[model samples]
Target: MSDISPTGLGLRHSLSLTAGTPVLTLTGIRPAEGIRPGDRLVARSGAVAVLAAETSTLPQAEMVAIGASTLAHGQPDETLLVPADQPLLLRGARAELLYGQSAVVLPARRLLDGQLTRLLRREDVELVTLTFAAPAAIYAGELHPVTRPEPLALTV
Candidate 1:
């Protein structure tokens, strides 16, 4: 697949996995500004999320670059929390991988970057994950996902 996506710039789909491999899932939440419980969240172009548990459905490809629809706005003090021990029910954009025997579940709380580095660096790294839902006006390419991101180093 082409990494030069209009939505995902600089993100390279170099992970050697089948089209339908289960890699990651929506699990937990991290502290961020302007985000609250029920506030719509979505992953930016290159942001990566770590899965906490395994699933029998959902595809792997969908886990690579996840995007979601608007979330139900919550009270200003309300916070959204995802358990580090299960999968989250996210709406908008489909997931290709299901957590299962063949699924690629990294260590609990471990984060996989846009290039899948945290996953490649170590198989047992637990990542702290969060789900971000964007407003209908915000779309991919307009926002950056990863915080401390390493550019994808592709060997052509």
Candidate 2:
């Protein structure tokens, strides 16, 4: 999948994906905001051109919606889907998970607040750091010895 940067563009014009395609379909009140077809959309996933069609149907629904899921070797095992059109959030200090004997860790950051954090925490979350930015320390309070000392001569 391609990645797109969310830069310029009005909030009402946020991008939406249809059937996992890069093409964006404008919905909600955005169309009333003068966001016509053929306009460009700046999405978190990437930029996409608006389709020349308006959807009068309701927003599509997903059977299983989770925030994030970890897969191994491109195999789908664990899946976390998030329903609704908003973001998720996770609280606490840190989050950790062990899937198929593999560990998945997510550090807490302040920017994770609101929807992002809530959505994550709502699902199968392990640890939460609860900070806007990662700790300034090298290991975030993880203790480790600097160096081993050499033996001294005691017979002198």
Candidate 3:
């Protein structure tokens, strides 16, 4: 959390994005989303999310594969899993779910599941923001990005 600065990564050099779904929702929660009248999945502020892949097209489109049941591994439709304490990538960004739960808006549409998406970038990787809001309604926390350690060097 310390390493993540207030300033997010730069996207000026990016070219395009692929194999991901960007999502955002202000309201509305369908039963398929997996939020029953008693489900309590809301948290405080969100954590710093990791973004190593690149993306483009949608302005502030985040490539996160959002879903409800982590048990079910597949596409994100109707159900969206709000990442707790995960980095919130801006549009055209992606989230790897680092730690801590920040304020989320909770996209009613499919979560997009960007974490699982591996986009083709103009560069090595790109970062995006993923907003989550409980069906109740929460404010944006203005969180930071997930910083990965330097590439590992293997030698003989």
User: How accurate locally, in lDDT, is each candidate?
Assistant: 0.26, 0.25, 0.27
Tens digits of per-residue lDDT, candidate 1, 1-156, equal 423435454432211111222222233342232223343334433333321112222222122322222122221122222122223232222122333233232321232333321122222222332232211111212222222222344568
Q: What's the distance in Å from true for residue 68, model 2?
A: 19
Clashes of each: 24, 31, 40
Indicate the TM-score of model 2: 0.20
CA-only RMSD, every prediction: 17.5, 22.1, 15.2
Over 101-120, each residue of candidate 2 has an lDDT whose tens digit, in order, gives 22222222222334422333
Q: How much is 107 displaced in model 3, in angstroms?
A: 16
Best by TM-score: 2
Worst 10 residues of 2 by lDDT: 138-147
Residue 44 error, candidate 1, Å? 9.5
Cα lDDT tens digits for candidate 3, 1-156: 222223542221111212222222223322212222232322233321222223323433333333333312322333332323233332222223422333222322233434433222233223332222211121122221222222222347
Assess the local accuracy of residue 22 in candidate 3 as a C-alpha lDDT between 0 and 100. 29
